[model samples]
Target chain A: MTNTENAPSGAEIRLEEVTKRYSGTASPAVASVTMTIPPGKTVIFVGPSGCGKTTTMKMINRLIEPTSGRISIDDRDVLDIDPDKLRRTIGYAIQQAGLFPHMTVAQNIGMVPSLLRWNKKKLAERVEEMLDLVGLDSAVFHDRYPRQLSGGQQQRVGVARALAADPPVLLMDEPFGAVDPITRGNLQDELMRLQSELHKTIVFVTHDFDEAVKLGDRIAVLGEQSKILQYDTPEAILQNPADDTVAGFVGAGASLKQLTLLRVRDVELKQEAITARPDETVEAVRRQLEERNRPFALVLDERDRPARWVHKRQLAQASSLRTAGKPIGDFVSTQSTLQDALEACLAEGGAAVVTKERGRYAGTIDIDTVMATVQRLRDEAGVSE
Target chain B: MNQFFEFVGQRWGSLLFDLYQHGSLVLQCTVLAVVIGVGIGIAVYSSPGGSAIATALTSAILTIPSFALFGLFIPVLGLGVQPAVITLTLYALLPIVRNTIVGLANIDPAVTGAARGIGMHRLGVLTRIELRLAWPSILAGTRVSVQMLMGIAAIAAFAKGPGLGGSIFSGLAAIGSKTAVDRALAGTIGIVVLALVVDGLLVLLGRFTTSPGVRARA
Candidate 1:
C-alpha cells in the first residue's frame, strides 16, 4: 500500500486520446476524449443517454475496453494491469446497486476484501466500518438479505460495498439516480460529507445537470457522441457558458444556478461601519440597532475612529438584563459566504458584528447579504431579460 | 348372480386379481427404467450440442416395434426381465433430456450476471441459482417421461417378464373370451392407474417446490 501522504498535489487522472468502438460500429462510442481529473476532486460526466458517459467510466476500470489511447492512473499506464485487479483497486458503483439476491448485507459489503483474501477478522471489521460509513446500522443490517432491503437502503449498501476495500479511486454511474428525489438529496449530502473526509478521486456520471452541479467539484459538460463541450467548475460554467447547448443545460434559470455556485467574493460586502459611543446607554444603542438587523453595532472612541465591534448578541443580552450602559464589540466578517454570514448572524441572535484589522470595528452581514449574494450571482450567471 | 359370485370366489377371480399378480414386475421395471432413463438424460443434456442427437436416438428407439425389440434383446441378454426393463428405460430418455436442456438454457441472463458479479464461481452459480430456477420445468419434463414409462411397462411382459402384459400376451395366445378379456382389461386398467398416480405425484411436487415467480408466470 503506497502512502498517498505525499501523493503529488492532486490525483492526476489522464486520458490520452481515449476512444472506444464496439466490434461492429464504424464510429467510436466515446471519441478521443482526452481529459485530466485533479486528485481528491470530483469530475462529473454529463450528457444524454447513450452518449458514452457510462462507456467512458467503465473504461477507467477496464470493465469496457477502450479501442485506442492510453489511460494513466497517478502516473502508470492502466492497460498493462489485469482487468479484475484494476477493478478491485477502483471502487465501482452503478445505478441499480446490483446486489446479489442471496447474500447478506455484510457479505455483500465484504466482497472485494474476501476476494483479496483478507483475514477473517479484518474483513469482518471492514464490513462493520463500511456499514456505519454509509449511515446504516451495522447491527440491524448485517444479517439481512438484499431482498429484505428497500431501494434506498440497497443503494447505501451498494455504496458501502464499493467502498469496503477503501480504494483510492471511485467510479460512480448515476449512483443515486434510482432513488426518490428526497432520498437522492439525502444520499448526495451523505456522499458529499464522506468525500470531504476521505478525499478519494471520484468520477461521477449523470444525465441530471442539477445533480452534477450539486456534487461535482468540476463538471465536464459533454455533448452528443461524447464531445467535450466544457470542463469547468459549476460557477465558471454558469458565469461564462460555452455555447447554447451548455447554456440550455444550465437551464432558463441560469442565474439561480449561479447562486448555487457563486462564492461570497462575487457579492459586495459593506466595508465602513457606523459606531455608537462607548459611553452611550445600552438603551440608546438598542434603539439604534434593534429590528434594523445590521451585522454589528460598533463601539467608538472619543474621536469616533474605529474602536470595537458591538455584536447584536450584546444588545439582546443587555435588553434582557435591562442594563443602562455598555459597549458592544465582538463579531465576524461580512465578507464570508452567505452560508457563513447567515450562520454568524443567527449565532448572534439575528445580527452578527464584524471586526477589521486588529479587532477594529467593521460592517456586518445579515440576511440582506444573503439576498444580495443570490441576486448578484444570478445576474452574473447571465439571466437574459 | 350365482356365476358372478362363483367368479369372485375363485382363485384367479377379477381383473384386480390379475393386476395384483403382475404389479410387482411392472413396478420394478418402472423404477429401474426411470433411474436409467434419468441418468442418460442428464448425461446427454449436459453434453454440448447433444440434444438433436439424443432426440433422434430416443425417437428411433420408440419406433422399433416394441415386441420385436424385446425379441432382439432376448437373443442377446436372454429372456426374463432384464431386456424388458432396459428397453422401457431407453424409451423414457427423450423427454427428460430435451426438457433438461430447455430448463438450463432458459435461466435469466440478468440473474446470472448478478450471481457472477457477487463472485459466485461456476458450480456455485449453477446449483444455487440456475438449477433451482430451472427445476420446475425440469420436473414437468420428468412427469411427462414417467407417464410414458407407465404405458410402456405393460409391453415389456412379451419377453417373458412378469408384467400385466404377460396376462394380455397369454390371453392373446389362448384366443378364448373367458380369460383373455379379463387379462387384457386388467393390464390396461393397471397402466392407466399407474400413469395417473405418477402424474399426480409430480404435479404436487411441482406446486410445492416451484418458485413463486415461476409459478405465477407459468
Candidate 2:
C-alpha cells in the first residue's frame, strides 16, 4: 500500500467566467463568476439556499456542468477529462453522509482505492488506515455497516472514503449538517486536523457562517446568482465584509464569531500566574502570593494539572492550600479557540483562564490578554470592531 | 382424503413424475419472466415516460384472460409447453416489472448522487448501489410473480402443457368417476404445496442476499 503521508500536495483550482443557466430560467443559476483557489487551502462557498453555492462547487468536479466558461485543476482543463475520471481524482462528500447502505464501513472507505484497482491487501490496509485516521477503531468499525453506526460515525466514514485514493482535491457540501451540534463541532475539528496533515485543496459549501469561518482558510461569501461578494481570509471576511449582504450573512455576534477563528494558543500566555502545589501548606502559599503581591494563585496537582485557584484571603482562613482554593470549574486547552477560553472565563467568573495540555497545567490567559489579542487582530486587519 | 391416498398409492410413480413436471414448468417460466421483466424494469425505470409505457403495456398483457392468452399463443407457438410457458411468462412480467420500477425509483437520490459523485460510472452505480439497495423490492416482485405463475401454470394444462393441470382437467371432464375427485384433489394440493415451498425459498433468498444494512430497516 502506498503511504498517504507521501501524497502530493494539493493542486490549484481556477474558475474563469463560469456560468450555469438552466433551460427555461430567465436568470442563470450561477452567473459569470471567477475565482482562484490556492493549493493546500480550504476555500468555502457560503450562501443561503438557492444562492447556487452547491451548484458552483459541483461544477468543479463536473457533477454539474457549467453552461459556459472553463474550470481547471492545476492548469488542466476539467472539460478535457472524462467526468468519471475527473471525479475519481477529486474527492466528493455531501450531507447525510451518503454512504452506500449495502457496503460495510471498510468497503465504503476503500471504494475509491478499489476503483483505482488496488489489490486486496492494499485495499484492506488502506481501509484500516483510513478508519484509524478518522479516530474509529478499525477492528470495531471496519466490518460494521453504515446503518449500524451513529450519524457522526457515518460522516467520518464518508470523509475517509473521500480521502481513500489520496485525491489532491476534495469537495464537501454541508458534510456535517446532519449531525448534532456537538458532533458537528467535533467533525469540524477533525477536518481541520486532517487538513493540516493532508493539505488537500478543499472546496467546502455550507450555509452556516460559523462553520465557514471555523473551517475555511478563505471564505467566498456568495449571493444570488452565485456572485462572490468577498473572497478573502476568514479574518478579513469577519473584520470587513464587502457589503450589507455579506454583513447580513455574517449576522449578529460578529466579535464572538471572530474569537472562534483565533485559538487560545494564538496569543502569548501570561506565565506570571503564581502557582502552588496541591500538597503545599496554606501558610507557604499565602507567603508566596504576598511576596508576588498577587491576590490569587492557581493550584496545581501532583501531576501539574490545574486544580483550583487559591486566594490569599481563603488561604489565611483555611488549613491547607488544597482545602482553601476554589475548585477549577472550567479550563481551556492549547487547541481550544479563544471563544472557548472566553467562555471558560465567563463560566468560571474569573479574570484569567487556565490552559491545560494533556491534563497538565500549561499557562494562563487573562481576560485582558484575550481582549488585547482580539483588538490587535482587528487593528491589523484595519477593522474598528 | 382416503380415496385420494388410495389413488396416490396406486400410481405413486406417475403422481411423483407429474409433480416434478409441474415444478419444472413453473420454474422455467418464472426464470424467463424474471430475466425479461427485471431487464425491462432496469432499462425503463430511469425515465418517467419509458417507465409509464412499460408499466402500461405489461398491465395490459395481465388483463388478458388466461384461456384467451394461452389460446392466442397456441396458434403461433403451437399447443404444448411452449404456449403454456409463453402465457405464464407474459402474466409474470407485470408484477416483476412494476416492482422493479418502484424499487429502483424509491432509492434515495442522495445515494445515487453520492455514488456518481464518488466517481462511479452509470453502470457501476446501477449494479453496485441502486440494484443492491433495491433487491428486497425486486425479490418481492419475483415472489409475487412466482406464486401467481404457480396457479397459472396449472391452467396451462388446457394448452396440453406440463404439470398436474392435466390430472385436474381430465378429472373435471369425468366428474363422477371413482378417480376423478382423487386426481383433482391431488393436483390442487400439489399446487398449493409447491406455491408455499417456492414462496418460502424466495423469503430465504431475500434474507440471504440482502445486505445487513438494507435488511436492518425492517
Candidate 3:
C-alpha cells in the first residue's frame, strides 16, 4: 500500500486556563496558562528546568490532571473520559526511553497495540512495522530485551512502542535528553523525517532551544511557573522574539539559526548560470559560458538533471561535454534548508546546484545570497551587532 | 553409634511417616503465610504509615517464642493442627511482609510511570507490572519464611501438631532412656533435610519463573 494513504491525522488539543496546584507548595506548579495545539503540527514547550514545561504537556494527556481548567481534544472534554482509556489513544515516549526491562523489544512495541485489543496476527505485524519505522530490525531485535539494546536503540524501541497503536496525538517529554550529542542529533533528524510523514499532533518538551528550533513548527517558550512568554512559529521567534528573555533564550547567532527555518525553495535561485547538455561540444558550452560571463557551465544528462560541472578551464582538456570536467560535486534540493545549501556551496567551492522534483535541474544557490538573507533577517528584527 | 543405627533401622516406617508429616506442615503453612503476607504488602506498601504498622505487627509476632506462641494459641484456638498452623504461619509473616514492602518499594518509578502512562489501569499495573517485577524479592522472602518454619515446626509438637516434632518431643520427654538420643536425632535430621530440600525447590522456582533480564547476573 502507499505510505501517505494510511497516514494518521491528529486531533486538535485546546487548553483553557489550565493550572496544577500541589498542596502546601503555596504556588501552582503550572500557572493559568492557555494555548491551542493545532492538529498535525509539532509544537514544542521549551524552557529551563523546573519551568513546568513538562507539566503543561502532561495536562493534555491527563497524566497530571489540571487542578483547575478545561482541557479538550477536538471539542470533547478530556476529563469526561477515563484517564487509562484516554491514555491508550495518546502516544507517550519519555526520557531514557522508559522501556520495561522485563519485556523483549517485540513485546514492548506490541504493548500498546495488544492493549488496544488488536488481534494476535495484526499486532505482530504492527509491531514489526513499528520496529522497522524506528529503524530497528525485528529479526535481530524482536526477542532481545531492553538491557540488550544500546541507549539510542532502546530509545528507538521506546518510540516504536509508543507509536505501535498509532495514536493520533503523541506527547514526547525530552525523549532524546539521555543520549550523547552526536546520537541526539541523529535522533532529532530521524524524528523530523518521521514527523514529515506521520503528521501526528505532537507536543514535544525540551530544555534545549536549538532542538526546539530544529523540530518545532511552532514553539511555546515558557517561563517559571509555566507562564507563556512567547508562542509563534520558529521563524518568528528567531527573527523577532517577543521579549528579552526569549531573545536571550534564542541566544546568539539568531540570524544564522533563522537560516535553518528557511528552505532552499523559499530563496530565489540564480538562473544566469549557463547550462549545456552532456552531448554538447565542450567548446560550444565554453563559448556560452564565456558569453554569459559565467565561470562555469553545468552539464545536464538526458533527464536534464545536473551531471557535471564543466569549467571553461576544465572544458579545454575534453572534447565532449559528457566526458568533460569533474562530476557534479554537491547539490541541494529545494526541500533542503538554507543552512544545508550553505554547506553545499562550501563543498562546491562556489555555486551550489539546486534541484526540484525528481532531481530536475532547478538553478544555483550561492553563499552570498544566504549571508544576505541573514542580514535581511537582522535588519527586519531591528537588531545590529 | 551401632545402637543408634539399629534403633533407626527398627523404626524406619514410623520415621518416614514423621518426616512426611513434618514436611507437609511446613509447606502448607509457608504457602498460607505467603498469601497473607503478600496481600498485606500490596495493601500497605504505598503508605509509609501502613507499611510500618504491618511490618511492626508481624515482627512483634516473631518476637514471641514459638513455644510461647503455641501455648498462647491453645487458650483461644485450643490445640492440635490449628494452633500449630496458625502460630507457624504468623511467625512466617515477618520476613515475607518486610521483603514484600521492600520489593514493592524498590521498583523503578519510571517503569511504573511508563506503565501508567501507556494506559494500564491501576489494578493492571499492580498485577501485571508491579507484581511481576517484584516476584524475585517476594520469592526470596518466601524462601526465608520456609527455612524458618522448618525449625519452628518442631516446637509445634507442644500443641500436638503433626510432624517429626512429635518424635523429638517424646524422645526429650524420655530423656533417660537408651533410645532417647536416636529418636531425637532422627527428628532433628529429618527437619534439616526438609529445610535444605524445600529451599532448593524455591531456588528452582525462582529460576523458572523470574525473567532473565531481571535475574542477577554474575
Best by DockQ: 2
Model 2's chain B yields a TM-score of: 0.96
Native contacts retained per candidate?
A: 0.05, 0.76, 0.59
TM-score of model 3 vs. true structure: 0.87
Clashing pairs in 1: A11-A39, A295-A352, A309-A328, A309-A329, A309-A330, A310-A328, A310-A329
Could you tally the backbone clashes for each prediction? 7, 0, 0
Q: For model 2, state the Cα shift of residue B204 in Å.
A: 2.3
Docking class of 3: medium
Off by over 4 Å in 3: A1-7, A264-336, A340-365, A376-385, B1-5
The alpha-carbon RMSD values of the candidates against the true structure, listed in the order shown, are 10.1, 2.4, 4.3
Report the lDDT tens digits of candidate 1 across residue range A1-385: 2345644233568888999888888888989989998888889999888888888888887767899999989887889877666777777777768775556789879988887889999999999899989999977999887768888998899888888888878888898988999999889888988888788889999999988988899999998668899999887787788999998887876655554554444555565454677677767777767657565666666654445565677676664323323434335543333555565667755555555555555555666766777666558556642
What CA RMSD would candidate 1 show?
10.1
True contacts kept of 2: 0.76
DockQ of 2: 0.84
Candidate 2 lDDT by residue in tens digits, B1-218: 77778888997888788889998888888899889998999999989999999999999999999989888888798888889988889999999999989999999898899999989999999899988998888888889888888888888889899898988899899899889888888888888998999899988989999999899542
Comparing 1 and 3 by lDDT, which wins? 3
Return the TM-scores of chain A for each candidate in numbered order.
0.73, 0.95, 0.87
